[model samples]
Target: MSNYDELHRFLLNAANVRGELVRLEESLQPIVHSVEYPVQIQRLLSEMAAATTLLTAILKFKGEIGLQIQSKGPVNYAVINATHDYTMRGVARWDESLSVLPESFQELLDSAVLVITITPQEGERYQGVVALDKPTLAECLEEYFTQSEQLATKVTLMTDMSEPTRARAAGMLLQVLPSQAANTDVKNDTQFDHVCKLTETLTEEEMFSLPVNDILYRLYHQEEVEVYPSHPVSFACSCSKQRSADALRNVDKEELLQIIEEDGAIKMNCQYCHSEYVFDSVDVEAIHNGQFIETRKDQ
Candidate 1:
């Protein structure tokens, strides 16, 4: 569990490949426990969280990246969002009638689509979509990279739930740099394959139990590896009282007042963190009057 909740970026300079490794624990616990998720859902969500964090580390702008899976299987929807700094939050929805959910990714998310969205602070938003036809989420992501970027990529995601209460997840990404792709020779391609093969040898026990540098050294000690400074990843929800109040302005004032009269307050609950926001008649009145009323958080 050492060096947990951090994302590390490294490069095998000689191989002309860039890699990202992330191990998550404390940050993942809160997201998975936000609801009474079954073991199946918990593992899937944790993997998605790790995958999102790994993808976020490549952002060059001050914005956010969102990964969403939409399907018609037992699990209808799941989404994870992360900012450039590695702060993340996620939520999932599934059919509750089934007592036992399927353990496989494709079984749980039949007829699914994986959507990757990137929004820059000052530029147009970009989105890429690929079918979730692969057996594993990691392979689906690899497919996305190969299709969209035309770059050879490999992704591996793992979760450890032996300790039910203190679950953890980690992921690794290896991709050929586009700048190097144009000039890649047979030897360069062979080196890239060698690096990917070494990464594939990682075991769940070694990934969860060892530190970042130790894991890298064990896998790439013989290569010219350059590791960068690590960044901490945390669970951070973007929901807020003010934002909830602003959302209320969209509805007719009379409708909100009616809800207040019946339920005593207009309640808004954040699915990501399960935080409740309550707004009374007065708050509604202020909000409809174009005044942003600040309500109490987490009722």
Candidate 2:
């Protein structure tokens, strides 16, 4: 299987429709292996990772986008973040005691809500919430696009969690572009439906193993697609010791002292990367005095 991670953009010359294809391997391995999650949860996280990557690629600004699931069932919380540069990280929380995995999204996440957040570098942050009424994450996301953007969108997500050591995810997005003429609405809808039907024939094996061009050709050989250069995707955490120290400044001094007294140092762990940062007594004092403080990684 190809382990390279990349995102590709394509345009349907015949129709006013655009598409994106994302394949994640190296970028998803670290995030999925950060914790010992159940196989089902791992699959969900992997799908979210691919979905976030696809969504971020369509952004017009420099910022971050996140997909968060808040539920009251076995799976409590799940989140995936992707930056404009394609750096990705994700985590999930679930009930460890549950022995049987839920068979459906509704069973796994009762009373769940999916939240999509977009933070632009220069404008106000935007968010949209959608009920998890669909059977799959991709369908739920399609609902989000229809309700929020008023654009017809189709999303397909596939994740291979069959092996504990090897993780792979891929997703494709197809959406109808905004039209200027009322007469073209019917024509655009017909084009979108025809292309979507072809996309629906894609399989998990092809999505995981096939190259972008091959996949596109196989699905849309009859149609003309204008393929563009691919963008590399990677797993990168935006966490650093300096950022950790800055976060410590917001903590109460007394609480910091108590933590130091109990453990001999204050430890802050980055949930995204699983990197630990430790601050000793002197370091805490520097933070209190409004001076720069340095921290050492926990070996």
Candidate 3:
């Protein structure tokens, strides 16, 4: 079984490939606390949440990476946002049925698409979209990386919410070093193909519950591996009243005042944390008077 309560990192010393494993049952529980979501929806979010943490750890840049799914089915949408530090938060919208768990994401989500977005701390954002034409989120994400980033990235996400209110979600990612030159001849393709075949043999159970060492050894025992120190992940939300105020500062005075008058106070909700920020008439006037000067510059 995988190690509990920690993230594990491993690498192939001979190859330009690396992998990571994490157990996030406790880390993700708080995210689903405020709502009574269906089991299927909760499981889905757990998988996505786990995967987002994995993606966040892979990034060598500063900023946030978000994963989103939109379907024409009962569960209208789900999204998980994560920063490089493994800070994450998620929320979902469903029209009905907490028992909407289908055997497959395709069946559960009607014609869904997985979208990946990256927002650098100081640069423009970039997004990549992939069709959820697979049976699992892991496959859908793998498709995105194969097509969008052109990198040989394999991802697996899993969760166990059976009892004891336990929720364990973890993932393993394998990708080739993009900087390495690929042999144009058929030989390189043959070796890459071999690795892919080995990785394909991984299972959801093994990934979710197996120890990181066993998981890696099971897949690549024949190859040399270099393991690294890992950073832990949790269900962290980056929301606050100050951030809510920053967003409000962009609204025109008329629009701001109209909202305030209509509701007696301007209410802003943090979609990530579900925290409510109420702005009274005074708060509204201060916003208009350039009290949040930095926000004005943003506008």
| TM-score (C-alpha) between model 2 and the true structure | 0.94
For model 2, the local distance difference test gives 0.86
lDDT of 2 by residue, 1-299 (tens): 55359899999979778899988888888888898877788888989999999999879999999999999999999999999999989999998888888866778898999999999989999998989988999999987887778778889998887778888888999888777123233345788889888999999888877877889999999898999888899999888888888888999988999999998988888988888888888888888798864544563
Clashing pairs in 2: none
Residue 143 lDDT (model 1): 81
List of clashing residue pairs for candidate 3: 1-210, 1-211, 2-209, 2-210, 2-211, 25-167
TM-score of each: 0.96, 0.94, 0.84
Predicted candidate 3: what Cα RMSD to the true structure?
Answer: 4.3
- Record all residue pairs in model 1 with backbone atoms less than 3 Å apart, i.e. clashing: none
Residue 27's lDDT in candidate 3: 71
Cα RMSD of all models vs. native, in order, equals: 1.8, 2.2, 4.3
Off by over 4 Å in 1: 183-188
Judged by whole-model lDDT over C-alpha atoms, candidate 3 comes out at 0.74
- Model 2 misses residue 93 by how many Å? 0.3
Best by lDDT: 1
Question: Candidates' lDDT values, in order?
Answer: 0.89, 0.86, 0.74
- Give the per-residue Cα lDDT of candidate 1 at 72: 96
- Alpha-carbon deviation at 122 in model 3, angstroms: 1.9
